[model samples]
Target: MTDEAGSAGALTATAGGGRWPDLREVPFKPRAPWFNGDLQTIRNFLVVEGLGRGPAPPASRRMELPLNDGTGDRLLADYSQGEEGRGLIVLIHGLSGCSASAYMKASAAAFDAAGYSTLRLNLRGAGPSAGLSSDCYHSGRTEDLANALRTLQDQDDRIFQRGLCLVGYSLGGNMLLKFLAEYAGDFPVTAAATVCAPIDLAAASRWFDRRRNRIYQRRLLNWMLRDAVRLPLSSTQRDAIMAARTVYGFDEVFTAPRFGFESADDYYAKSSARRFLSGIETPSLLVEAQDDPWVPTASYDNVDWSVLPRLHRLSAEGGGHVGFHDNASRVPWHDRRILSFFEWVAG
Candidate 1:
């Protein structure tokens, strides 16, 4: 995909001569004034502070939001409160990231600024409750999330009784999209947003296999492997996992079997959001970076946008994986974009 900005406009397959559509082309009017500072500079400062100080948000204020997935899993939900008058924003983090992730906290801060309460759902085995579940969360596991949403809806009915908005990053994005598609009008989500999602897991796996993507591959694989080791499994299963060389091999040996899929192909076929996007009816926005090393631009082509009239696709030029550092100012373009989109929808 070419990186020529502003040349490509529409999200149609043929738009921009097959290159991913530029985010600027999407007809979105920001509810708040455009941030005037240098974003990259801010991103650099934040990165330094992030690495040195190691995420300074309050120790996540969590609650035991139970779920009846029939597996007897105890799902723990966490939230950071906003000012008195704002709405509610529900956030889901990426594969290994929990509610404590910098992006999650930053987004929560943004939502809070707009007077919105934020709920960060920690997938079954992640975060403080890692010891609570024997089975880990996979991309296809949406039942727990569905249950979480229901719980949120019930709680909101008592509190705000207004609207609920969702924003998910990476794997969480895949879950959010799939949930919306599968549960269509069943839930009361007013608007949704997904960032740097691995919409097509097969293509994403291939993308991560490239030489330049080795660092990302190694990082993620190591995390998965570490988590796999933490879980309880049979000796044969443990041996199979220990013998795996690559991420694909590990998934084939561990994730596929544990998740009840015949293989990774079956998991990808069923879980990839591209296949389910056509059925989504909620007003949703999908923001992806063409240069993301983990998620491929090719997946965008697989989407059937015509079936989802309220869906908007924003493919920008320079976000890396979930990194959308626009300039040295350290201000995130995607964060601003998300706030803008939600503000419009909320209005």
Candidate 2:
């Protein structure tokens, strides 16, 4: 948690297979809490600031990539034009988030500023495409993601020539990590980064069930449930869904079976990236906050960094789930950290 001791040491000691340049010299100061140090107050401030007014990017071009679902639902990828650039950076959003989400927009702007082409992937049934598919996307779904990456790669063989970078937020991060692990040598990704990911889905579900996490739990669960109810399912599926009491129960009842998994445990076991961290071959960065209310540090602790030498786990003391606002100006600490890590990796 202390940046003074250097993160590189922790990364090196933990990571065994991948080689990383010594970043011990990278000076980083942990941000202090605002609003009398009350996490709730900090959370409220960030929710308003991040989702509220902010700088906007230039006009974006929207394109739909055809899928084989026979549902006529094509994947939406938004491109924010920038000065001619070499590499392409694909941004994936968290649960219930779309290409239009605030964080995704902000990241697209950042990538454009860095002279990189940006593509914001809207997961099936996320944004405008919600009505296109009766089936919803779950955290464990990786086939669409793999297909998207391949589509991008095929669209531009230049992707392999320049480089490909993936930036996934929260649930999207979990998906990205799982995708990388599943297609370690098959993909052409040069680097990837996951921000505030709930690595251990099972732990996260239990954590959200706690009294303090109730508000967040209800918000996410309601969103997911609303989506599930919209899906055209058999009477048995509807019965199972209607009988669910909590988000975990709903996921176990609906998501698990739909995804070909036995239950929540099977889904979690198959989806969690911690088990696959040792197998990641691409240069990657996993950033989590010690105080992330939704994703606890314990979930991150399950990661064995020593096996996959190319991965760096960055744990900051104060960023709230994707809300890494710093100082009175509300500048995002996570964004700067992400840029720095990517620059380091690219260089």
Candidate 3:
């Protein structure tokens, strides 16, 4: 990839100040006024840019990967590859997301076109894999991903031939970081990248409840509410879920109790990826937007980066919650940057 900025080196010293270079040295152009800041974020949900974004590579096949979380749950994944592959990228979707999420599909297509194999994975309860587990999927559920990859590794040699990496969005990004920090050596993961991850779970909850971000909170809660009714809940669990009116209320009533967390506060405290950033062993890139409506900048600001030798932060001042949509390329800015970073790590 060539730099748009008139610079000699790929590593430009950025104000975000880290051992790694700036992620957006070339700058991003949204191609429209409505595609700016928070609007860009909302537009992503409202419109499918596939019109002028170019054709995505054809999907190969979607397979059901068995989860070894001891719950006998099966997760779904869409695997696609190009001829003469470079490596595999396991995609973890955000909350209320699955293999079918627009961002997930867009990123998969971009990666596939770039000679990398992609697996768009749906969490335990997301997509058609919903009924496979009685328990709901949460931001803390990294063990499920671990199990899925292990199962794949045992059966497919291609998974490890070139390299294996992970790219997660939003809440999925938090779990990806957590899994890398907590279980880095357990899997042969070469590298990992996260976009708009709510590293501080509590801060993210607060952000969600804010007036400006309520639309996202409401939409996500609506999805959870719709799913709660279908979950295999006992009489009491069903009652508690019905009583929830907010994000905290839902987590306190259903998420904490079902997952063995003492309370909502405790769940957020333990599950927050901020606490695990320093412990990450594999080389990782965490992409965050300063203007994100649902995730606070402080979450990335207070992190102890010195302890994370293998981790890097791509702190962009304005990429609102995974909305790094740029018109300069057919692929999203995050996808291009992530693929570039992954290729660098693979080499």
Candidate 4:
């Protein structure tokens, strides 16, 4: 809570010749029956994703981006055009999530409604593009994102004038932050946002290992294991991945070795977004629930926000990992809040 950038005063700071909207003032009361952190988190799975919850986005045009790396790995994305004047918003999904994820679709619908075209990207070996890549995506795969951006720019000339905005969920958010920091002046990215990101990968992994988070950990691990086994990995790697019980174990056995890390600890240390946060010069918003079931608040607490002037954060008391269901509005709280941030930056 030190430096608390979401405070009223901090929210009004000048940017792009105008004052930024105070998104913190927009309250997020947990909806009926989903009051506590656990309830909020659980509600996400219980509710159907795109079954008449809101206006479904227009059918998206599928685009495939081949990674610049010699590996011939390709990533797929669904692009839907909106009011062109507003610009483009690229949405990145979390671990085990795809372009078809509930949150991604909801957020895309919200952005499309607000006049920004949206692209829902599937990282390496995720979603519909699971078979397109032999290598899996790690938290530090900024180069892949860079390649995607370059491809997008080449495909659409408007991006050069209107600029680009990015929104990432969970692990995807960590990748966005690292990309912004590491490739600061590379892309024509105007603004960015991260929801429920584990900036400190090591800390988040330890939290996931906790007994209270066992169920969530098991589900995520199973999804990952299933997807990894489908890849063209060796039988030994497949057996090792299946033998892993926890997320940390999976990372230690599979992720670390495949990504060229000496070990899980080394991978987490090198790939964590925390180390790159201070280097971020782009305007960005970070949304986190203190009671997030997986990402520990202690990781957010350890950061010195004073150095990250460009990163606006909202560390809510409760919303439960990516589940910011608001009582007052049918639209998700984060969708509304992030749109406001993008508007401010686009101004």
Ranked candidates, highest TM-score first: 4, 3, 2, 1
lDDT of 1 by residue, 7-109 (tens): 3332344322342233464332221222222232223235624564322343346777656667666667667666665667788888877777777776675
**1 or 2, greater by lDDT:** 2
Candidate lDDT values, in order: 0.69, 0.72, 0.79, 0.83
Query: Per-prediction TM-score, please?
Result: 0.83, 0.85, 0.91, 0.92
| lDDT comparing candidate 1 with the true structure | 0.69
What is the model-wide C-alpha lDDT for candidate 2?
0.72
Q: Root-mean-square deviation of each candidate, in angstroms?
A: 6.8, 4.2, 2.8, 4.2
**Where's the lowest-lDDT run of ten residues in candidate 3?**
1-10
Which of the two candidates, 2 or 3, achieves a greater TM-score against the reference? 3
Q: lDDT score, residue 272, model 3?
A: 88
lDDT of 4 at 218: 84
lDDT tens per residue, model 3, 1-347 = 32232221366543435445445665656646645568768766766544434335457686787876677888878888755757788999998888877788788877877777888888888887786765668998888888888888876865777878899899999999899877768877898999999999999999889887777777888888887788777898888887787889999998898889999999999998888887787878888878788788888888767656678887766668788777676577778788767766665
Which predicted model would earn the best lDDT? 4
Worst 10 residues of 2 by lDDT: 1-10
Q: List the candidate numbers ranked by lDDT, top first.
A: 4, 3, 2, 1
> How would you encode candidate 2's per-residue C-alpha lDDT over 1-347 as one tens digit per residue?
12222233333344575555444344233345442223522453355445566436446888677566566666888976555545777899998788877777766766676667788998887876576666677886887887767776667666556667888999999888888888746776878999888888889888767887667667777777777777788899988887877788888898898989998888988888777766677888887877777787898887666656778888776666776655522335566556656665766
Candidate 1, superposed: residue stretches over 4 Å from native = 1-60, 153-156, 304-307
**Root-mean-square deviation of Cα positions for candidate 1 versus the true structure, in angstroms:** 6.8
Angstrom error of the Cα, residue 101, model 4: value is: 0.6
